[model samples]
Target: MRNEKMNTNPDAVRQPLLQVSNLAVDFGTVDGVVHAVEGVDLESAPGETVAIVGESGSGKSTTAMAVIGLLASGGRVAGGSITLDGRELVGISENEMRRIRGRDIGMVPQDPMSNLNPVAKIGTQVAETLLAHGLANRSTVQQKVIEALSAAGLPDPERRAKQYPHELSGGLRQRALIAIGLACRPRLLIADEPTSALDVTVQQTILDQLDEMTRELGTAVLLITHDLGLAAERAQRVAVMHRGRVVEQGPARQILEDPQHPYTQSLVQAAPSIAAARLQPEVFQTGREQDAAADAVADNIVEIEGLRKVYPMRGSASDFVAVDDVSLAIPRGKTVAIVGESGSGKTTTARMLLKLIEPTAGTIRFEGNDIAKLDRAQSREFRQRVQPVFQDPYSSLNPMFTIERLIAEPLEFYKRGSRAERRSRVRTLLDDVALPQSMLQRYPSELSGGQRQRVAIARALALSPDLIVCDEPVSALDVLVQDQILTLLGDLQKEYGLSYLFISHDLAVVRLISDYVCVMKDGALVEAASSEEIFTNPRDPYTRRLLASIPGNELGIAS
Candidate 1:
């Protein structure tokens, strides 16, 4: 019904705008030629959406990259047929592909922060696409840029065009990327996890705008994502990929209702859906009073009272208030999650708790000691006791270091044990985090995103910290990997009594992992309650909106 304006009639016979047949892609690694995608077949009609759904390393992105002729270095189409508008594209030259790129096939890559030019203004980037494609000249480029941004649902497009990517939030940056991708009004749009990093409300807004624009343009879409709920909601057809192959392909609703493949079934089960019950029901079954009584018996691991952070602008009279009078507590061995959109002060609050940034005002008490007033020795002890597992595992782990050394770095810094003992500890930590001991020799680049995140967790656990600040730890991960990581975190907490300061934009994830949830908006706490209370009976309007915006809420079908 959401796609009624577009051509989504399955019974109608029509030529596909884009097509691929028996596509195989290979990457020349140091070891050998690795087949990344094999015998894959896909197609998308004009004004239709086809989603490739899979876990990380399942070759969905590789397929998209191959389609766009932008495969990474040493990757090539080993054997495949790729046709766009009835034109073969497998053997096109770089020049020919460049001409086809913006004019016919536009891409909205994942991680807008990386895809966007950090130094270039938003308008300049949009103008480059239009100019390169001969869609706009210098005289009309500015107007075109503003129009593109406005079409992408960006507010105040004129001011936004003059600003750089860093000046925008994640959602805004994603909108800017959308603006750039659609500037030339391409026939086919390849969106690779475009909304994976965004909050639910923002994701809904972006997807709605994309649907509307693509419907109006009659553009075909190749959506590459790991989210089953997203695919079910957005795509007409879903192609399920696993280990370099399309294992199943069918209508989205049919795939969701009666998935034949075991992998597809697993994906549906693992995905955190709004309609599904919490993963850890026991954590909620214990009454809030009992948990509070336990916390009263044992001290809260960390406490914040009227915490605030202000960044002074060079010329602005009113300083930027990042975290305004935010106050919360993390009970010992319990997970207290902060859920908010980008720039909502959740991460800033976590950074302050980790002592990475000094708060402008208020108090942060860790284990009954004021962290701000700690002595040199006490500060060192606090640093050792509280560690962080940052977002973006791709950047968090040191590429040059082996997984062994990366985990051992904190142990070595703390002088926890002898060389042999630290190596053994690293192995143990890997085991604790569900990583193989054999991975100790591999570098970060050699591992998948989930494995890299596990390594980051191992490194964080190496310090034996009482509190771990997880800032969107699983945001970029697939549902299965995210479920694994969340389960691992819960198991580790139970085993080690580790407290967590979890910050994320995903309410489903927060519901699954958190004992308590703090909802933040515009640099302030709007609601704080038990996870059960927040999810079932949220009092705040923003919280209700976030819940409503979750992908599967409308479907109401159990995963």
Candidate 2:
């Protein structure tokens, strides 16, 4: 938070660096004309951050794309004007827009994998921005790219420059995008959900870097995000949109603390950062059912001891220890979460527990039987009892299949029912996940991101596994939708005596669902305790650092 906030002050007068007046954008679709954005009026003065907060398909990203004249096929601006530094942008020629793109305006798109060229090295991409804008020559561009990458908080920039997008981690890829976006030193920057794909700590670091870079260059920022609390914490002014229109706009903190629109109120209320506690049992099903489930939990369903995983190094006598001697217990019908950063071996530990990978030295006991010694028939049964729900719902599912077939695949493979019975079970699973029956016929691409995640959860439930391994399940979702999915998981846990080995980097989400917590760093458990103890009185310094990185920690919002 800066001492002098941006986009606020009635007395001060200055020309807006970027002004969007009555911006109406539409797409010619097969069904009809899709009114993506209509009559949207907003402005960002120099060094200001005006965040457009809304859910997916609320026209937030579309508005940014249209302003930059990079609208996808079949998309066009129907009415209104978008001006940058008093220059009209809507009716400009493609060549003119290209000239204006890297020189006058820069964009940081949401997905780094799709945004960054996979074939090229990261340094070359950043150098292209500088070279295209005539900001640097071939000789100076390499040094400039390294500086940009270092400024974006990427470690070992010189080595990272030679690597491609697929070789880098998610956070590093995002930093690469930031390096490209800010390389030209543009007057205006449009960041479209720039931090959505990162972890909490990485997200905070990227945002702090972006804020510093834009402030140093005096760049006006048009930030479009779905997290209202994040918008309040980062932006000086907030604009709320629903159904392709700006419903409310005002100072950031004021808008969040005292929202005028009903839609904004719903957003604020549904935010998990605001509601720091678990969802009410009544919100799920009934208090009595939840109480009964709590009363019935008495035994440990899965127990691990001395878990150690070592990857043999290539051309070396040493082995890379991915997981140290770690031990934990998951109580029946309780969720135990493992939290850490990338390369901390959280995913490796989860994979070992799921029996997808073998551990060097470990005793994994499920109901008092060692999993390592499971016979052929028992291994098949273990697969039925334990299921995994991975992150990246987009790629986790088979896009070629319909929603109904996707859900029924698990049941069909497990031989749970006949064709008719499996279809009936698919309908029930959809209801359990709170999705629509009509969605069964739809493909994964046809549904929104949130809808696709819900479908993935439905498919996970088709087999009714005893234990579910959820790895960063809702990390890609918006605040509103993340809360919904967490509540849905809580309700499902109550209904079934299910246990969860939840793996996540988000401590806020872990606090809402997990009964116990384990913090891992560099392949070793630094601290382990109950959820409340871990959050309130963490004994380890690393745990404290992780809690400090949470965004929206200072926002004033009600439960």
By TM-score, the best candidate is 1
| Runs in model 1 lying further than 4 Å from the true structure | 1-13, 283-298, 556-559
lDDT of 2 by residue, 1-559 (tens): 4413443444322678888999999899899999999999999887788899887788888889998999999999999999888889889899999999977888989888888999999999999889888999988989999999988878899988988899787778988998898888788899998887666777778888768765677788889888765687788888998889999998888898899899899888777652365553223313244446546864788988999999886566898899999888787888889998776888989999899999999899998889999999999888888888888888889999999999999888879988999999999999999998999998999998888888888888888889999998987777778878888888899999789999988777787888778899889989887776777778899999988777666763311
The TM-score of predicted model 2 comes to: 0.92
Error of 2 at 448 (Å): 1.4
Error of 2 at 360 (Å): 3.8
| Local distance difference test values of all predictions, in order | 0.87, 0.83
Model 1, position 271, has a per-residue lDDT of 82
Structural similarity to truth (TM-score) of each candidate = 0.95, 0.92
Q: Which residue pairs come into collision in candidate 1?
A: none
Residue-wise C-alpha lDDT for candidate 1, range 36-155, written one tens digit per residue: 999999999988988998899999999999999999999999997999989999898889999999889999998888889999999999999999888988899889999999988788
Weakest lDDT window of 10 consecutive positions for candidate 2 = 280-289
